[model samples]
Target: MQARKDKQVNDMVEKEKIYPLIVDESENIAYISDPETYEVIYLNQAMRETLDLALGEDYKGRYCYDLFQNRKTPCPFCTNDRITKERFYTWKHYNEKLGKYFKLRDKLVEIDGKDYRLEICVDITDSEVHNKDLERQLSAEETVVQCIHALSGNEDMDVAIHSLLEIIGGFYRAEHAFIYECNYSENTVSNTYEWHRKDLMSRKEKLQDIPMEYVAQWKEHFEEEEAVCFPKYCEEGEARLPEILQGLGVRRHMAAPIWEETSEKYGGEKKIAGFIGVDNPTKDIEQVSLLHSVAFFVSNDIYKRRMIYKLKDLSHVDALTGLGNRNSYLEKIEDLKAAHLKSLGVVFVDINGLKYANDHFGHPYGDEMIRSVAQGIRRYFPEYSYRIGGDEFIALYIDGTKEEFEERLDGLRDYAEDECICDFSMGVNFGRGNVNIEEQIGYSDSMMYVEKQVYYGSVLDGRRLQHKALARKLVRDIEAGRFEIYLQPKINLETGAMVGAEALMRREGEDGEILLPDKFISLYETEGVIQYLDCYAFEEVCKLLQEWIKSGGTPVPVSVNFSRLSLMGSRVVNRLAEIRERYEVPPELLVIEVTESVSQMEPRALKGLMEDFEKYKFVVSLDDYGYQYSNLAILINMNFVELKLDKSLVDDLKSNPKARIVVENSIDMCRRLNQVISTAEGIENEDQLNILKEFHCDVGQGYFFSEPLPREVFLEKFGGHHVF
Candidate 1:
């Protein structure tokens, strides 16, 4: 009786079951198994329908693999790495017989004392909807790659279009694809390429005349920014069908514009690149989506291809020689100015005798002469050349330096003299420290003119001749203890004690006299002899400061005026770097003054050059502030740490209310610009100094502090004292 009761209870449990066993509730087959022994213990009703096996009869005692195939061992893909410790694992399997994707899932489980896995699988025949989308995307990618390769293949637009159509036809399994090239010269759209599939030439040829009605719609669509898609079904009934569709058996198609980017204003008319029509209807919706994708891709690819071709065309000729230009020489200079490249040398070269050759031998021979000169120029500076002017050329040598540049110039000059009856002049400029390319080129051009005058035996008659003589005489006079480094004391406005001194350039010719830079500066400006004089004076002042420092003298900083021309050129930075290292002096102790004119030209390039000066922590002061077009925004943007007010502002402020207001506003603006405003040219008296002090001028350098004195006199009188 007890045994009968236990059987009845077991029967009740079996009837209820542990999990659901309904047919409609299950979309996929489900089964449970012992992981180690690989025994199938349970099967849902869906499993029976999937394997065509009876749930309780056929697969009850079988291993999981036995249901799929009679494998000698477990499937390689079925492993703990994938299934163990995971709630579920899913994968797809393509069935040859069914021709469908079967999405399978394996659930991790542990039953009784052994680990087990649950297998669930769905037929996934409907999943092809998603697969079709993916396949369409794949086709799109393939078409894009093909179009890229075709466009990149050649410069000929017709051939590129032909290749593109061929690729489209083959990729989409279409019977034919053709491109109608719009010839703007003739104002007609002609067939450039007509690709036909095998065994379909007659039908494809029958559709040669694609009819105006179909093309008219395309014209209207492009006019209204509507893309032309053919076949009523693919167009979703939005577009009219092409008449060619009826004769050629073309079930679907896509057409896009092949336009030159600058077509409208350039008198280029609308071009109808021929339609890409697929002969057969789409097997699935995959082909339905191909139209728009291919249209956009073709348009974009054609544009990119055309641009590449145009670029190749532009980059072909030599800019300097007006011959075949080198790649990137012209490119690099513009790039450097645009801040794309650094340390570019702008080399200015002038043909020495091209003018003479043109005049004496007539222009034909002169042209030949110029060509010969160009050949020689090419041999030395082979990479970059530009015909900037008739007899002038420019070259941009990357990573070029003053020395390398000089060597190249000298070599080119020698080569020109040796090979022909002419000479060439060259100059190089860059951004080094406070020096910039504009000033470098300016100086270089001046030097070139000077050298040219010398070459032509006209230096004595040129403007530079007198200036050159004056510079030489001044240099000699200075060396002979005639030139003096006048110390204009820079005083702290509040303390009235000298903190620094500006080394003003003064000279006495043969007789006893005090001459300012103005008297000889214009002279030295000719050959850039001012730069030389500055170097000489800078060295002398530095030596004096060194001795003062060594003798435990007061720490006094010395400021020197730099030529606006020199400071804006590359040499200033390079030379300053060299001098600072050699002298082993703190950059703070040596202040280099800059004028406002440097800001007018080459602001962008100069800003980039400032990094070199700022690197050594050098003090850069705007010597003549409130001069020129001084924009507070622009001034504050520079790397200058000090703003030196012009002496004109300080000297006239007491009597001039307008000047006083300007000074006060300038001071306010400088405070916001984070600049220490120093005053120069302030030589009136105590009243001007008091006004400067009230304005909170940080430092003052002028006659009020102390009159300009020689470096030795300055050291002897105020070296030990706190001369402020």
Candidate 2:
């Protein structure tokens, strides 16, 4: 009898419903349970009253899915089954008897290691709402399919991507959405699509709806192949993104990327194809997985879509110059830096006036002249070059070493002078290594003022008739091979072996007498021929230097004075860039000098120009330091690589204690700021050199060790001397 009673208890426990709790206080209904089972699992009074079910009828021993669904067993599609190792079902079903639709959600419970499934049923009897929800799902699927087809068909990629995002937003009932893609070639991710609700779009045409952090999250997704959810608009609660979103009234968003597979065969080819996202203004929560799937879908299709966008991208590229269009350069720079990398140089080049040539010869001749300069540079710096503004060009070089690069400017300068096409001025600068690209650009422009100051100073004399005539004669002679390149020995004060030499420009008159820039520079400047003269001198110097490098000459950094007149226009930068490319010259070997006083343009305008100069990898020096104490604020703000003391300071430092103190103070400040301090015009004796050395100057240049010589003469005399 005891064994029989135990069996009865086990059977009761095995029943689906065993416990019932219903009080007769509020409603006229009954809670039913199976006598065999002990679980209080029936919703009788509350559920029967709500759903109009019959009370007192027992639903004991019946499973949740079996009650709501027609199936006797668990449904195939169920999440409860995943959590618990039990047969389970979802709300999807067709009831042949009642022909009613009902949706159910379920949870699993464990008691003494035994699993039981609990569930709730919602009467989804309204056919309209059910059909509408189905329609929404179908619409989203169709839109995804359409985007895939468009992508596969190789249509206009940007437009297709934008439209695809729109369809996704509509399907998901989102207020806004966007797509971003990673470029395998550039290793960059850029915005591909963005859309806002029609209500918002009608109000604000330019929607600043997307936050940088959102874009940043997508980048992380691309890198890590993970999904991101923005629970709040801003994680730091800094109100930055929250403000923007609140303006749009958007509160929540979900983003994901289409990740590329890594393969040894395509070592450098791994990149995100694209990403898709959705945003909702009023919704407190978003369906994260769905958004991620949409993003992944978009990214997966990017490979074929890029082929179509390629043509559009090419259309924006200048065929003659191979540089980005004016419209594209600004956007490209922003995107490039947003990817968290620094541009080594931002070189801005302005071609000397073609208007004069057009008026004198014809438009065709002027165009050819422009083409010549463009072709030269395009062929030289194939990696990066852009014709951004009218008669203005920009180029970015990744491997720029300033001091080394300036030395190679001779070839372009010579080419321009020899052709006698047009004159040019250039300004170049260095980046703060880790600073924002905009700041880097600003600094470069400020350095350019130094070049511009000299340019303006040169053009002053050319405005007069007499000065013009003399300048034209001198320029013609220089272009006609009447100039010689002088090389000055740069002794390694430590060893005296031929280290390197400075390439100085001088005009060889009809009598074979050499005249330096100071003698005829005024003439060139006044005659509007300084650009040609500068180019002639520069190119001649380059040819000789190239030869020296080939003829077993010691490799030492060479300093070249790029006359302010020579760098008056943008063409100088491109021309120099071409020269470096043509000769395969390393940038570290070149040093360019500019007077700080020359770059007096508005800070905003000059900043980008100077930064562009440094992007080309040439060390920029203030040729005459201390003369422009007025502009020192801007100079310090722009950040020069070297502070070259003028001969005025060098000549007076030893004789005048005050002058020495100034020089010493300047050196100290430069040292603290990580700027190089060098002495120029150190001449006559070792005493001056010793004084410079004592002041802890990094380098010295002038006529004491040896005057500028011909390239061959320089190599013969100073080649071994420059070696430490």
Candidate 3:
């Protein structure tokens, strides 16, 4: 048909009348062009109208494609040899500039023996809008499927969801887009993910914790199987935007509801789960409706993840103490191993005396004790703690030091002490680099056991067991009358007369041989059984005093040794009172000797016990003064009745100038405080005794007087009148 039309155009041009034939002012647009140059030679009045040309515009030399198709050259289909390829060039295509489509029919022609092309074009865009809409719907569907993959492929859900929100927001030219996870049971919606277009104000943080009641109208609209589009706020009162939307400057919004049958955790019913919402978006009802596909796939991803986490909580969290369970610790160890470790610290904590508490106080109180310890640990290390055993907890610090962990450990101990929960022993070990994580953890565990032995040590584990056995044996011996007190004479430095005797403990062994401080004292102290031994020794001293009084002789002052364990217990005063009442011994007749370590005890508690001894009229002597850990400052304030110089001071007193000066200065300091100084230990020669006498030491007791003897022999040798 276009060939015959071009033949007619050629015949008309043969007559030199083609311009008159195509010049009608009608909707059928026609233009004549020089085929080789694609230059427009003539344009009909309808073509001029279609191009929106000016009344005086000329088009004789302009490129036709540039004018109509917005191309720099001729249209590819409008070729010089087009009639040779086909009878006519007929096609329909859209024009972006005009926001419409055009259909064109073209054919080659010869006018006035010159080759030209005749083109007729018509608008066809409005008739094909539905087909374009279908293509856009398919594109959006593919995008939603790709987003699901992106969300699932990433390990971090927050990052994946945020990326998806941005993609969706960008597709619709939206200012803001976000996901709100509506927790129906909790009656709240949490803003869980968001995207803010570049240069736009973010309302992600602001639009949070919204209750459904606040968006009641929005929820009502989302029940439809399409995006709830609010193109204009409050266009109808029944579909009014919430106040929050107004505050967010959201003039238009489109949201797709995520609905699902609820899990049993949320009461198991069909409901709107959450929604993906966009604010002030580009206006297109079809494009916005397509967002429902994204909401559907993303909501399922969220639900599946929540269920996985819920199951993980059941397996990974400790039931009794609510701490991370042992399996969690193993997982943490893997994390630690995988880390590029720099100054990673591991703290091993064990609840000391937990077995004792459980056995003696019942498991209920023991459970409470464990909970108190857990609470204390959570104060500083809330996230990394693990209950790896019944009474053991492990805490990790990825970038912490041994010193910082130790300080926190001390605070935990203090808390246990104050709460009376149970004592805890902790060890800290820190290292950097890709070192063995398990090795560091084991090292920390070993250190913790060592610490545990120092405070409320358990008898069932470690080196303390031997000491515990030794203490038990000594206790059995004391019960069987196998322990005896030996008195080492103390003499007046000035008067050259015996003034007192320091009661030394002696135990009869299975070999019927004598046991001195060397045989038992160290173990007793380490095992913390010294408190019992001290009480027994004091009772024996009382018996000796009563015997001396009944024999009708003047009894000298006898000082008995007391350990750190003796001063700390609440039962100390009562035990002393009971023994005092039993022995009928006045307080002045018996002196109490406190060891060097008393300074390390809780100062207020030790002071309180010391006051009680003072009230009872007992001579309170600070034993082993100037020894390791002993504080000379105690003498300056408390006015002790005597200061027994530690064996260290006397070990080299005769030869060492420093030792001599220490003893001398200590004696002088004691005199200033109105207290007496008694020197003991390693005093085996007259030179040592003479050194003490010259220092103005008020008293002395040691092997120089005589080695300690059994109770019977001591009574025979020293209890008699004028025995000195």
Candidate 4:
């Protein structure tokens, strides 16, 4: 919103410039007035003092003409007559009531979609200096000096750029002056530091991803170390000049290329950072040397600021996650001690089972989990979150009251757990003014640890704690998409043709090792975290199906195993339905594979859950049929399309008569019900394969034909072979 904003106020520069600068207040008086009402919205102390008015009082909404001149009505000699929505007017005027002459400049500035006039009135009537060239050069140098002073402070970079832009704009007498930065990574350019004459529109929002190749000629001139100027844009022929210069409505243009004295790789070559340009609508090119000098000062200031940022980043930013580092947290402690912060809040976040993840899934998986947690912190509380230690984070809440902060923290916790799969323990404390930030952080961390201990059953046993911790890390990995979807082709035993494949979940380990599901599934199953894992697999399968469809392929029925934990509620139905609709995958194309434990769960609830899937038209199969308690009632009630004989039965088919009897009975039952029976595992030899073929098995998955393959390999090898 527009009030009595300082002359250097610019939204573009102040928000993203990270490193800010501090500057002394200008001696000249300034104020902004609503043009429609001729009422003052802001009047600075300098203006009040010069007008013989009281300071620190409510002068806002006062009639500008009446307050300054004590007039019963409007002033007869108004500078606004020369200035319009697109015009800036600068002149010397004598006040009728005050009996004093002043040098003034006025431009229309829009704030919050409202029109106002920014009036900068300098008391130059009593000045003894009269040399125009000397004054102009001195003024430019003075503004540069003030900007340099600001750069010395540990303030924001936006403020520094704003101050520099203000000086350059006034020096060139331009309608607009802006900094165009090149994003080397994206190979694009954007308008960053921008200043428009009051009431002028900002073009920063409209300028995005401008290809550098579009302005090759302009850059070539800068490479020659010259401030490229094209005073006559329309007249410049397209044969030798860049057409992009004309594309922008640049009339009288001059820009100097900004450079940094550092390199991306240490001891390597220095590089060109970007460029600074100004549009001179008034065509005042006499101060060309002065303009270049100011641009040089800016170039060096930016370089220094970047260097400082680099040094600061090393100490302040976490190397693994890029969140605020421990050093940054400690610095904030001092800042908190110094300032009287009203309603300061702190949220301590600790990742569960990080060690377990690192040990079981490998450090890479653990690292990805930590990064996901950090990303969540940034999403919820940017500019306030810190990575204080391995798997430990802290967030400062300063903008809200204690209650508000607690509410937001609660919402964040729920979101992270339910949607992001980020299992975390959070402890928070906040309220009132003048709090000990360090103590609060410690207190919050302690509360988090206590809760964590409670989750571990308050036991001193290391193995139990370790296992529970892994469960927590598994949540993070699942949330972070750290699992790989490998497809094991299921072949038709009788036809000797490839059919559908089962989606297998695998995690990446050290040196690109593929960690299998059997490695940790049992532990997760025992801990009841298998439900989330199953959901993750389902979501990934849905995503893969959509991708295959996008690539112009008809996919087969992909089997996704379901846990008993997921069958207890409508949560899985809603989640799976949402993803199914999003991918536009028909329900019949996705096979729901149920573990034997699910068949043994609360029979009524299990039947209802299976019915819900059937209602959605999904093909349901009982997976690992002979492993656990075999309740034959589910098979009759659920209306299954397939049954998978347990691996134990198939592995002992040659020696164990009981296993063979169970397998034969299962296959015979499947035949009676018009169902498909698939025998998996222990299919390494032809004898075992032939045995399954004799039993009239429909499909088989194991190392006999092919192991599980990555998406790329699967697509290359069997994705072309569609069952439907």
Candidate 5:
């Protein structure tokens, strides 16, 4: 028993020596204290060094709370009750006294049959600081992603900029964010975009045209630094704030410059166009990198907006006279329809003898004359003038008195005369309120035309004089039966049989020379005499049909061309029916041909005219089908027996594949519509004829068959019958 007792004492001594040695060598802080009295029992080397204790100092009477927390009483955070002999309690804590973070492991330990608290503390200050930096970097990356999404998702510059500002302001916890545009030419800056936190009054309205000198220091700093940061606004020092910022009550701010590539006209240098900034940021005010990234995107957007505006300006303005172009005039007309005006005045001005000048002098001289006229007009009505055409200008005045408008008009006339500008025909129209602009413009145009006619008559202009003389001569010739009917035979494509004849009008000149319709038709139409010619041709056709019927010959169907103007007249169908009855000719034997120009007429009116023709038992055929305004809606609505393809389409049938497709589809479309006959005009070659035949065209008429022949020649050749 004595030997065993001695061995136990020896073992205890050895264990105690080893424990102190191991604990002293550990890097972690370790300590032991009495559980009840809170007195320090043992302290490791690390613990002594951390607490500034001497290497061999006695810690027997010192309390653990006094050494660790600097308190006289037991620490409230002590883990004596929480720790057990079998398990270690672990926790992380920041020590206020030491200004460090620690990970602590606590356990209940026994010495001499008494319980005590033993704690091992691991310093984690550096780890904690590193973690915080990682979190900040992650947050900044997320903010950048959101800003990029906002910038790319919105197309409107205003909306995109506002969204970016909102994101940035919220990210930095700023009170305000804004963008300022710098105008180097004007030596000024303006707050173009701004965002403020909720309940904050906006300062954008008051920050207009601030002198560039206010931001001189900022510009200098921007050149040297990635961004300009003011952690705190100051006065009366090297860090003095601008008066503008002082007035704005800005406490802290950061900004980045927006740069743009200047055009060659401006020396092709990179310059600061604007700046994006935040004010009174609550956190991360030193993160200038984010501001620089946002500025890059903003600069691109500003450049794009400037280019769009420049192109839009070019499109709306005339290059010659610096006035609004035709497109602008059309948009203005639409705007005027919705505008509120007490009084409205319109002036229509046309430069007379423009074509004469253009033909005699070079185009440059004519252009100069036009420019002079435009300048004179602009002098009187600068704000509301447009060069709608090469030599035409229109001016509008709103909420103006008639007297005022007349005075301006007189001034314009005097300016033109005094400046020796080109001669002008001016027409004026005025209304009280909410008048029809179209009708007013039409009336003004008519007045202008009358004045132009008078001027042309007074002057010795060849084109205008010839137009007038031809118009008068045409009226007399129609009265004297100088207009004769000619016929172009329509042949059945497969059999070469004469199925029909179209009655064309020709003028017999005084020298016994034949004048084609092209030479005089447009002139007569302009003078409103073509409708009379149409009636005369119809009556003469009726007289011939009467003769053919009396001669007891089987007369083929004869088509008569009628102008749209003549068809629009009241009771025209009835008058045509009366002529048919007087001639005692069969209604089926006469076909009335209307050109495609009638497609532009009112739908209801055109439909009514077709119905009238049907009522009179007259067959109606749409002539010049593939000409201008080839509307399928007209064909669907009208009761037409035949559709005549225009000569232009036939001329290109062999050479143009697209035209061939169009013609083939057109023929197929007509075939599906109640078996409407498709006649191809101007089939001048055998290739064209074969192509039309391949497309199963119904009738063909052109020089390939014969030119237009006089009435006597047509009867002598075809014998007023279906000639095979």
Candidate 6:
């Protein structure tokens, strides 16, 4: 009995010694609680300190929820049902009451014949934070790789840029992502691209062409730190938000500068061309390194796109005049053809004295002349003018009216005459409703050539000399009766009867030789003296008609040719009327001949002239009708008694079937109109005459019957007979 009592005493001593050693001295939290009552039965030193209990303060019999969790009820995470005596139950938990993470081991135990719960916890706050950081780093690396792949694989810059922005915005949880290009020379910045969250509105439209001053602070930051990052966007005690950022609702932002490296041939400097940026990012605002990496790819793409655009521009632009070059002109022609335009106006312009200027004053002066002409054309037709050659330009206007085209042409002419040191020969054609562009351009070009010929002809045998000397010579020759008249008979094709005669002009040289009109007419026209010669010829014809009437000889109608320059005078028609009325010659006995090129005159003015001639009861004939730019509109609109096929059309009648067809159609068209007389000039043989007779032509005049004869020779040859 004494031995059993001694053993019991030793067991109690061992329990008391082991409990304090294992629980009281441990650094981890340890606690024992009654399972049924949910009360804490024991607390170790770590648990007492964690609960802020003073030394020796009693924790026994306290509710575990009230002590460990400060809860009024048992902890929902008690783990009582999960604990077993077989082994410790291990779990992890975050203790809100202590603001720490823990790994806990809990077990069921029996103490003094009562069941209790025991738990031990190890704090793991530092390790948990470290692990979370590692996860974020890996995710960031993956996102960056996606961005690089997107930029490298796409050939289209816009697509690549959009993909990159989406990737960055999605990874950073940003409300907006964008790029802004800087034009240092212009002192401007523009929002070139943007991506916004689904619920947010895009700010790109409103942010264009912003002054660089708005982002001066950001650029400063870029220069110093290679980026701009702000969690709250405050700078140097300035509490007020910048208006630009505030307008964008940007509470936090980050950006990295985009840079380009110049070629070593160009000094190899790095330039800040633009920036990539994000607004109001929800995460990773401090990851400026990612933005820098993206900026490198973005800069390369931007540089490549710009280089391509510049090369394309160079290909389509004239280097000296800044006008569309030949390539652009050809491309525009195709576009115009495909457009099926409602109306079109084309103007062909040629510099008249370019070759003269280049030969006399060097190529620089000629270049200046070309540039001046291009500038004038662009001023009127800004969008569609092209410099197609060294001294030639063309302009096209879609849906433009004839009147508008003529008005613009007049304005260009006045501008050239008043402002430029060079002269221009310009031709214009306007058509409505599905007109052929190539045909219109060809017609306008033909008209331009006609005007160019007139210009060259007016320059004293195509040379620049003292104008005073030529003027005086022309006046002396006119006053000396050196200008004379000749006649070419128009014959009826079937009977070979002379129906009429065309009066031609000749100049008598100083040595008594006959000079062709071409030798002096252009000079006379240039001196503005052709009107006097025209009046002279008309008066002489009136005299011959009056003499024939007094002598009782049969007289045929006589047609007199008038220079276009002479006809342009306001008093020219009146002068001819006065001479005809003074001589008492019947108006029907005299025919007035005007060349087809008169079609180029202003429509209103040409119509007025035709009406004035009709008012005088004069027979009007269209001369040289098939020469160039054969305008059917003029023939249909004007009241002409005769249409003369030009010498060129008749010359090729035997050799070219196309020419025969054209002539046949022309004669058929004329014969259909009011029985208009179709006269074929330059008939040289029986084959030509037979062709005209087969086509039922009305009049034939050429060297076939007679060369132009002097007045005395014509009267002597067919004095009494009207038929030859």
User: Which candidate number would show the highest TM-score if scored against the true structure?
Assistant: 6
Candidate 4 stretches with Cα past 4 Å from truth are: 1-247, 250-308, 316-526, 532-558, 563-590, 594-724
Candidate 3 off by > 4 Å = 1-136, 152-159, 183-187, 210-213, 223-226, 231-233, 265-267, 286-288, 305-323, 331-376, 398-403, 410-724
Per-model TM-score on C-alpha atoms: 0.36, 0.35, 0.40, 0.46, 0.45, 0.48
* Ten contiguous residues minimizing lDDT sum, candidate 3: 461-470
In terms of lDDT, the best-performing candidate is 5
Q: Over the stretch 1-724, how does candidate 4's per-residue lDDT look in tens digits?
A: 3543542453333343211211132566777777778888766667777777754576767898888878877777776656766766888776766666678878886665656777777766455234555787787677667656756553788887876676678767787888888888789888888988786777777667789897676577777645767553445553243556555666577777776665555566656677787875464465555555666777887777778888978888898888889999888888878887777888898877777767765777678678877887787778688999998999888857666776778777766665443356788888676677777778898999888887667544445544444566677666655788898888888876777888888986545577898876776777566777887888888888888888898777889887777666565676687888988988877888887677666767776787677667778778888786687877767778888877777888888887777787788888888655554554666777888878777788788888889978988888788441
What is the lDDT, from 0 to 100, of the residue 53 in candidate 5? 82
Q: Candidate 4 clashing pairs?
A: 13-158, 19-156, 19-157, 20-155, 20-156, 20-157, 108-198, 108-199, 343-432, 353-469
Relative to the true structure, candidate 3 reaches a TM of 0.40
Error of model 2, residue 592, in angstroms = 1.5
Better of 3 and 4 by lDDT: 3
Which tens-of-lDDT digit does each residue in 296-401 have in candidate 1? Answer: 5566666677578767766766443554443444454455555644455566777765554455435654565466667766776776666656777666566656
Candidate 6: C-alpha RMSD to true structure equals: 31.2
lDDT of 3 by residue, 1-724 (tens): 9989977765666357665555552458888788778888777777788789999897767998888788985667555565432365887767665677778677776666676787777877776787777777787877787788779888787888888888788777889888887877668887778889889766667767888788776677776556777743355644666777887677877888887885797699878878897887774545865678888888888878877887979699887778899999898888876777777777788876666656643575568667767887877777698899998999887776677767876776676555433457788787876777888899999998888766643445433433343354456568788877878887666775777888988877656788778776775676677788888888888888998888888888888988877678886876787887788887778888876666666778867877776666667778877667656566655657777788778889878998898788877877777546555565777888888878878777677766777767776877753333
The lDDT of each candidate is 0.64, 0.59, 0.75, 0.73, 0.83, 0.82
lDDT per residue as tens, model 5, 499-607: 8888999987646688898976775676455777888888888887788778777677889999898898889999999988988889988999998788777888888
Q: Which has the higher TM-score value, candidate number 3 or candidate number 4?
A: 4
The RMSD of every model to the true structure, in order and in angstroms, is: 26.8, 23.5, 28.0, 22.4, 26.2, 31.2
- Cand. 5 TM to true fold: 0.45
The full ranking of all candidates by lDDT, starting with the best, is 5, 6, 3, 4, 1, 2
Candidate 4 achieves a global lDDT of: 0.73
